[model samples]
Target: MNTQTLEKLREKLHDNANILGNLLVETFHYIGLFAIGAVTAWAGALTCWEMLHQGTITVDDILLLFIYLELGAMVGIYFKTNHMPVRFLIYVGITALTRYLISDVSHHHRPDMGAVYISAAILLLALAVLVVRYASSRFPSSNTPQGANATDDPERAEP
Candidate 1:
């Protein structure tokens, strides 16, 4: 084919690909929602049973519950808003990792070095969370401004 024909064909292929990609994304989104519902129901049932039978809940168990809750909430938010809050996911990940470290510390007979390493990792993660929170607060997002827009600058509009 000639160059013009090839370009047109490529554009058509690109448009079709984009449409297919969007449809696949929507399908996966629905599948994810279904999976989240199933898993949340299962986890809620399990937690209730354990609470009733055990008569008490441990910190680790509570942490696990929070993880499940976060997962459910994240999925719900996606369904409602058609977007996921990445910051919330990061928080959930940090909580999960911290819970795992705490559980390991309580259950394991590892050496001091292992404990130190785990502590270091937790500290680093904590620092990361703090940095992200601070940066977001300071800069804000494009939709949300940190300060009022300048309306007194007509000359600056040309730039």
Candidate 2:
């Protein structure tokens, strides 16, 4: 075959392979996100069921549900925008720490360094969330046009 013809055939094959690879990757990515969301919901439901079976809801149980909520929200955001919001993870951390601190204090009935440490961790996570929000607002991503806020773009608006 002529050199030009051979080059064209090679380019066509590469393009087709790239397209197939992208499709497969995207398909799996979506499937994985859906699975994560489903598992989070299932876990939350089981927690509720256990609470109901006990005929009482504790603060810890509620806090755990909130963590599941944040996880589901994070998964949903990632699925929709292909972007993970770091703030949600931080929120989860804060909630989990608060829950632990509460549980610890309630069980121990005494002030301890462990509670102090957990409180400090929660504060740090809260500060991290604030920093992230400030940075996001102050230095909007390149994907967003200048002077245009995320709210201006419905698709990019925070949930």
Q: Write the per-residue lDDT of candidate 2 for residues 1-159, one digit (tens) a residue.
A: 999999999999999999999999999998999899899999999999999999999999999999999899888778766777788888889998998999988888997888878888888898887788778777776776777866753234564
Give Cα distance to truth, residue 55, candidate 2, Å: 0.3
Write model 1 residue lDDT over 32-127, tens digit each, in one string. 798987888699789979987999977888888887887777777677656565655666777787787778878885646776776777687778
| TM-score for each predicted model, relative to the true structure | 0.65, 0.90
Model 2 collision count: 0
Clashes of each: 0, 0
Candidate 1 achieves a global lDDT of 0.71
Error of 2 at 14 (Å): 1.6
The C-alpha RMSD of each candidate to the native structure, in angstroms, is 8.5, 2.3
- Return the clash pairs for model 2, or none: none
- TM-score of candidate 2 to 2 decimals: 0.90
Candidate 2 residue 35 C-alpha distance from true site, Å = 1.0
Best by TM-score: 2
